[model samples]
Target: MRRSRDVPLLVERARAGDPRAVARLITLVESGDDLLPQVAAALAPYAGQAQVVGLTGSPGVGKSTTTNELVRALRSRGHRVGVLAIDPSSPFTGGAILGDRVRMQDHATDPGVYIRSMSSRGHLGGLSAATPQAVRVLEGAGCDVVLVETVGVGQAEVEVASLADTTLVLLAPGMGDAIQAVKAGILEIADVFVVNKADRDGADATVRDIQGNIALSERGPGEWRPQVVRTVAARGEGIDDLAAALDKHRGWLVEHDELRRRREARAAAEVEAIALGALRARIGSLRDGTELPALAARVAGGSLDPYAAAAELLAQLGA
Candidate 1:
């Protein structure tokens, strides 16, 4: 285990925009190693400053292209950017598929950009369990914006909304009909609807379909209405408009105090996840020792109800 004193030097290097130090710090968080608490303690003062943006859609909707272009756009404005691209894990090897990383190599030479691809490791909801923590590392490393691109699973990808300050649901024309889009349930989680490949045919219809659906949704006065932005990301068109819309959303979040509320909710979820992880570790320690298997046998034989067995386990943990 590393002492708390040993983490500050890495943290300081990361704060000074040393990519190797930032990568090392994030690697520790992602590995869930014993040094995590000390790293978190070192990073505690520097996080909560980056704007987290999430991008999700079905596969082949140009998510990688958009992310690449978006990074360029942000960089053009002198903002340091970090990208956490969640890729589906290879079941045999437990490694990332690396397709997204390959596409994002345009930024490989830029000192201000850091791009990391993480395997989802069979976690549902299109994100890795370590994603939020990795975002904290990037935030502490002084990224102005951290863009999280999900694994591109259709409906389950909505989890990003809870983790991101703003969620962009990307759509490409002719990928599927508008009804198919609604069935994915992406509408409910979208803070912005991006119609990519806008130079293609039917892009206008796609835009109109989204606009109509959003208009039908019920809302009160002063609600933050999601804007539809069209982009040909490959050609760098409409990116400026998309960036402006991001700024507008940021302002709206601050003006309405939504940022504070969202951060509070995010923090609460992080605490809950950590507590659950600790409980799981404690349970694992008891599994083969004495309590768990005995309880299981009793329940299996109908001598003890499952609820009672669970109560016993909880009592042991609490004790």
Candidate 2:
């Protein structure tokens, strides 16, 4: 229920690094508030200012732990960081089932860091529907880097590839994730393969398995190859190697001009989603009007073919 007039002030405060303003703006985005369009417009100028990195993997792979360490690593280099942890929602109450803040207490008192956990609310693709807009909010809040941590759902989480400038797919030893990576099509989306928990038994075997798969894949000349980094995130071991891998990938993205291409594609997808949602809303409104019912009646009576009736309905809706 945010007012449209307040959007400008919110955006101004967010640009000045006000955490509460950033939180309020993200809440509006998540709730689909009536003034969301105004909020988006106010924040549009700051789009693409932050480096968005997505971390996703199956449950128990230590995504949150890795993210916590990664934030510390990034902050060490003086980067203002924002984290959006998408947690699975409770089936009954529709609230976040896991609280990420409990695990990332080190940065709770840091003014340069902002962390917010969003419930997936049964949304598919391991992310909340408002994730892209929420990223925009973080960018507008002057964060140099934004981390998007998925809900850790298997297979369906590949959608993160479309949103992230660089996508990190985490796997651990003894989980058979190296084999699952192929079956789940994770090999195609991973820019960096972080074999976390490197201290575990069979860790080398898992790394070898992923390297073997990477060797078998075909790539065009100058295409970026995924880098594999091992880490024991629980003890903050090998985090520097992980950070180096991320920086290397970022350099490649810039050198190849892939960053602009990826951002353009992300913007195109966001625009299309908004357009489709508006169309669906308009069609829903027509459900209570005469056009849809008349069309349905004609089709049910077999007096008009469904294709033609649909065309007429679209025409009536000025679509």
Candidate 3:
């Protein structure tokens, strides 16, 4: 049951620029539910209003710093921005922030910028399950731009790209073994490859490596040729150009009907996510879930086979 009877009111107030209402709305979305119809209806009016950017990279690659600079850059352009920084520590209890505060630094107090830290929350699918919902909430709140920063959880890559309008894979210069560092999935879907810390050694090589990676990434006719942008976020270098690249891509997408395609794709993925999440939830609700523990005990005693148990669960779900 939803703990908030005033969710709709909160949603309305948030849209009216009420910061407290916005904060409360963030909490509601951060803790997601199977209420997709409500979520979709609430989000219909704001669709196409926010450009969601997913910023992900290896740990210590300054993804947070780059994201902060990007947010500042966008804000200077008079755009409202919302950030949901996904941290790895929340995977267990859905409450970890890792270095979000340390990374975001000073943006928390900005009224135009809303930033929230999310934990991985032990999701089986890698990215936080509530992440997509958070995106919708931010969009509904009228942010012109929204950023989702992943937990840097290795190469699981998860489904961030599927939820975002654009995905940026940030790489720092001199973070060596360039040839062996490209992650697939989300990395392959990058609309912009950012070589941050571009003033550092090996920056040139990193740029080349990223360019090569983009060359290998999927491309369609004039496929919005993904650009390899070099930025020294610490010094605010290339910030405007990167922003320009983002705009250029957006314009190209709008020109080619790819923007609509991407949103349709996201909507499809959202449906799939809801179906899968519901299936998992239903299985979890079976017999109060004691079926799993008892079955595990039986397997431990060698009285049953784990594979067979899984088959039974699938059969129960009509899979």
Candidate 4:
């Protein structure tokens, strides 16, 4: 645990581009340290400063490769970038299973970029529960862009839309992703669709599938339509087009004033999660006390109904 007094200094160092300080702050966020309140307080002022882009797709869709090329493209335009790659957790160790981040080794020595692979730790939404706080840490450290790459858990990955200002759904030929997108409700969440591995066979068909789906969806006047860009990520092909699409979407977000609304919703969800966690902790504490057990006994013995017993428990905790 870090001393609460050190939080301000750490935040200051991070803002000055001290990678070690930034790393420490993210570690604190991931671990849910006792001083997290102080860290969040210190970082609150920098909220919503970075362009948070989330990249998600199936496991074999070249998400990492696309992210790497996108990072390079963004850096070419001189943007300070941060990447949070959420990898599946090792069941035994509860650590990031793909911690090496082999595809992103090209930027390891680039001080202009910060990359961190976080364990999803059994989190169901393809993201770690701590991701939002970690993103705040990166924003406080002066990153102009933060790319959140999800664990690619398919159907449950729509949660990324809540955290990102722009969500890119990557697809590859023969992956059936175009069809799966409809069934998984991904069509509603995607801001841009990237048909990666565009040099492969069936690439054109995949693009057409997505385009056809987009045409079928109804939209209100002036609503932003999703764009599709094809890319051969391995060869660094069409990356500029993808970047252009992202910038265009960002401009639209600003023009339509959707960015502020999205950030406000993100903040509200974070607060609600924290409040629910505190409530759960209070309930857990009552297990060691008499309130919960007494309530359980009454409910089990038919002396009190379950809903009334729950109400009594909440009342006892002053909830």
Candidate 5:
């Protein structure tokens, strides 16, 4: 356990761009330890400086490759980048199962870029519960841009939309049916769409399909429409265009005042989740054949409805 007294020092060091200190602070967040509140408080003032960009897609869509190229492009423009690559968890060790750390080794020698791979820990939304806090740590560390690359599990990964200032949905040609993208609800969340591996056959077809889908979806007047860009990430082709699209989206967010609104909603959701987690922990303390089972039994017997039983449990907890 990190001493609570060390939190201020960590936050200061992180703000000075000490990668080690930044990493340690993120570890404390991920551990959900007693030190987290102190760390959050210390970092709060320096947070929210970085632009968060989320990259998500189904598995095998080359998200790691795209992230590497995106980092390269952003760095060339003199942006200090931070990457949070969420990888699937190893069941035994609860550590990252994927080799994103290896894949992003291109930036390993660059002081201007910081990359961290985190295990999803069986989280269903393609991100670990600790991701938002880790992002705040990166922002406080003076990263100009923070790229959140999700675990890329299908469907549930849509949660990334709420977490990023701009969400890029990556799709590769022939990887799957184009309709699957719609089914995954990616269309609703995407601020920009990247047809990666554009050198491949059927790339144009994939782009067309996405364009057709966007046309079918209704849009409000003055709403920022999602733009599509093509990229061959491995070859570094079309990356400049993708970067331009991101800039355009950021400008639109600012112009429409959507930036403030989105961030407020994000904070609200984070607070609610945290409060629910604390409540769940308090309930867990009574799991030794206490109130929960008695309530369950009553509900099972039909003498008490589930909603009424839930009310009883909340009252027992003084909710």
Candidate 6:
């Protein structure tokens, strides 16, 4: 664990564009040891300037390719963009795959662009616990745009929806019936949709399906109706329109107090989640047989009801 005093130096180095120092700070935060709270508290002052955009969908939708193209487009418009590509955790190191080095091919030499691939770390939302902190770090370093790319496995996975100012849900043609049946959350959370891999067959049909879904869900014309833009990301087609749609969503967020309220709610949720997680970790350590998975198994066996077990464990720990 780092000494708490190092946070200021780390922040200064990070702000000065020292990637090593920034990387080290992130390491200290995501390592799941001591100093997590201290690091989050220290970085709190430097957070929230960047607009976080979450790119999420099922695999084979070419989300990373689409994201790479979008980065190039956003940069062409003179924006400084940061990308957090959250991949599967490396079991050996309990860290992320860190495959972003190969995936984000275009921005290597551009000093204004920064990319980091994180491990989901068994975090169900497709975002690691460190993700929000990483976003804050990029915002502190003056990144005007931040893109979070998820693993894109789960149905209706919308982890990024609550975190992002706008969430881009990518879908490709021919995903078929099972994938298509995913559900309302994914469709409902999209601020703007992207029909990527548009050159493939069924592209037009997929567009219409999403359009019809959006129409069914929208309450009225006054509600922000997210537009589905087609793109062959590999060819960079429709990149301009996608960027424009993101900008339009940002403009709407700027005008809406409701969006600001959502941000507040998100912040509150983060605080509560962290507090509960830390408290559970501390209290569980003090009690025998109170580990999360064990308790879950016991509950599943009907040996103990969940509420009673939790209360009993907490009481046993004097928590």
Clashes of each: 0, 0, 3, 0, 0, 0
Candidate 6, residues 1-319, lDDT tens digits: the string is 2577777778788888877766776677667647667767767876777888988877678887898999999888888888988775546422323344576767887888888877787777557877888888787676899998875556325678878888998888998552466665776788888998899999989998888887777466456788899999999999999999998988888786656777788899888888888887877665554375677789999998999878866766677
* Lowest lDDT block of 10, candidate 1: 90-99
Candidate 1 lDDT score at position 214: 89
Model 4, TM vs. native: 0.94
Question: Which wins on TM-score, candidate 3 or candidate 6?
Answer: 6
Give the Å shift of residue 73 in candidate 6. 1.2
Candidate lDDT scores, in order, read: 0.84, 0.86, 0.75, 0.87, 0.85, 0.78
Cα lDDT tens digits for candidate 5, 1-319? 3578878888888889898998898889988888888888887886678889999876667788899999999999999999998776645322333555677899998988989877777777558889999999998989999999875556445777889999998899987564474564777899999999999998988888889989988899998788999999989999999999999999999999999999999999999999999999877876775788988888899889999988887888899
In model 3, where do residues sit more than 4 Å from their true spots? 1-5, 33-40, 90-97, 124-126, 155-158, 184-187, 215-220, 289-319
Off by over 4 Å in 1: 1-4, 90-97, 154-156, 177-184
Report how far off residue 278 is in candidate 4 (Å). Answer: 1.4
Q: Model 2, poorest ten-residue lDDT window?
A: 92-101
lDDT of 2 by residue, 1-319 (tens): 3567778998999899888999999999998888888998998999999989999876678888999999999999999999998776746322323544578878988989999988777677557778999999999998989999875566445777888999998899999844664454777889999999999998999999889988899888899999999999999998999989889999999999999999999899889999998998888999999888988998999999999988987887798
Q: After superposition, how far is residue 4 of candidate 6 from its true place, in Å?
A: 1.9
130-204, model 4: which lDDT tens digit per residue?
999999999998999999987556544677888899999888999874566445477789999999999999998
Q: TM-score order of candidates, best first?
A: 4, 2, 1, 5, 6, 3
19-77 per-residue lDDT for model 3 (tens digits): 78766666666666544457556766777788888787776677777888999999999
lDDT of 4 at 30: 91
lDDT of 2: 0.86
TM-score of candidate 1 to 2 decimals: 0.93
- Candidate 2 stretches with Cα past 4 Å from truth are 90-100, 181-184
lDDT of 3 at 222: 72
Per-residue alpha-carbon lDDT of candidate 1 for residues 251-290, written as tens digits (9 for 90 to 100): 9999999999998998899889988888899989999788
